[model samples]
Target: MGRQYAVIGTGAIGGFYGACLQKAGLDVHFLLRRDYDYVKEHGLAISSTFGDFTLPQVNAYNQVENMPPCDVVLIALKTTQNHLLPHLLPPLLKPGTVVITLQNGLGVEPEIATIVGETAQVLGGLCFVCSNKIGLGQIHHLDYGQIQLGAYGNNHQPQGITPTMRQIAADFEQANIPIQLAENLLLARWKKLVWNIPYNGLSVVLDATTDAMMKDSYGYQLSEQLMREVIAGAAGYGLEIKESFIQKMLDYTMKMKPYRTSMKIDYDCHRPLEVEAMFGNPMRAAQAVGVAVPQITMLYQQLKFLDARNIAIGN
Candidate 1:
């Protein structure tokens, strides 16, 4: 029998990738909240740079309990919602199931491991994609969509590529989404932070998209400095991220479409920003290692204030 996949969060990241897998003929069951009714009746619409397609019929469930146990489960919710995973994940687990967290920030896989326990394998999926849920059951993919998969190891050590990782990668590859296998999940998470820390935070604070940040002299320079601090933080943990990678990310952003980052979008909509996951956890980790990240610290504090105030007023 083929792998039965469960997508835990049917938002932008989960919906886009799950639809791709289903489009490739995989059995993908989606667990949704608000869009459950619309998607069940109208299916999913994906507008992407790769191409555009629609899933006229999908296996959609409003709750995880209604979904079947599967070989793989993809958790694509923002880190802010992860607290609910303890309640949302159990119903979708089977023996030997592999849970892949397609989330940003450090220390995510560990929390997932605690929830699923010893019966499942946990992996970290680093998504370098620019995607957003534009409307109910609609996701617009503007730019890159490659994922880096790595095995979670004890004490944050490298696990090397495992058989399970290869199997998951094969499924994503068959769906026409690019995949990179990382031997060190910790290193990959840190590398992703290099891009995320600067753009996601600055976009909200500066009230600008990536293009504007890259165009203006001050914005561009500030981004570079934050990137360096993130790199230094990684080094404090014995992970080496080269300085040249900073320019590579900057160049990539320069070429990307004028886009609002996920954090910025959340701020605009009065939805909770992932202040702790995307910013707090990383900044605290760096501090724990005796690395001072003044810029990241300030950014985290500012986002915290804004996120709290925005949500309070919205409520």
Candidate 2:
């Protein structure tokens, strides 16, 4: 039997990985809604700048009940759906099931670990992909579709995960993609957080591309400052993300020329946004460490108001 895997939320991240693994001949399933029905009729359609392929038919579900026990569960839902995990996770999990969480908010590792326990392995991931869901079973690839996963089992520890993580890394490496067992996964998460916390909000507020928004005098300085504050707060918690790390982040941002944060995409579609996923958690962390994240706090509040107003207006 092939390695059975299931992906919850067939959006860009989950859909991309599922399609890859399925194309590689592994048994993969998806939990979706009407998208599943559309995909059932139209199949999985992926069109990328690099290439395009169409899967005639792929498995998908409208609810958690339709899922079967799987060896691995990739959770890729928006951060706004974090609370829904407690109700949805139990049915699909069993002892030895690995639940890989690719969610965006901060401090979710612990919550997931607490809920899933020894029955499932909770791992964190950072996805560099900037994609959009163009249609059911169709994800429009923009750029930077790479992923890095934490090797730690839970709470940033390596216990009970060396062999499995090595296998995962090897499998991904053989798949001809950049995959690594991060030495300091927490720091990696923090670095990625620096990109999201400010950039996501900045893009939504300014309604601009990364290069257009970030290249300007004001946006550039503000983004860097917000990143510094976040890094300092991380340092207070004993995670020292060095200056070099920040420089690399800037390098990555520069490459995202026409980039728009995922939240910005959500804003454009007038759909529900994951403000708490990228913004709520970081500001909470800064407060916990006594870091004065005045700019970040201000940005978060402004975006929160906008998101809330949109939600209230039933947009």
TM-score against truth, every candidate? 0.97, 0.93
lDDT of 1 by residue, 1-315 (tens): 468899989998999999999998899999999999999999999999989999999999997878899999999998999999999889888899999999988899999999999889999999988889988899999888999999997677799999999999899999999999999999999999999999999999999999999999999999999999999999999999999999999998899879888899899999999988888999999999999999999999999988999999889
| All models, RMSD in angstroms | 1.2, 2.0
> What digit string (tens of lDDT, one per residue) describes model 2 on residues 234-312?
8867888887777777777887567777888888777778876677777888788787788878888889888987777
Candidate no. 2 TM-score: 0.93
**Global lDDT of model 2:** 0.76
Off by over 4 Å in 2: 152-161
| Best model number under lDDT | 1
Ten residues in a row with the worst lDDT in model 2? 152-161
TM-score of 1: 0.97
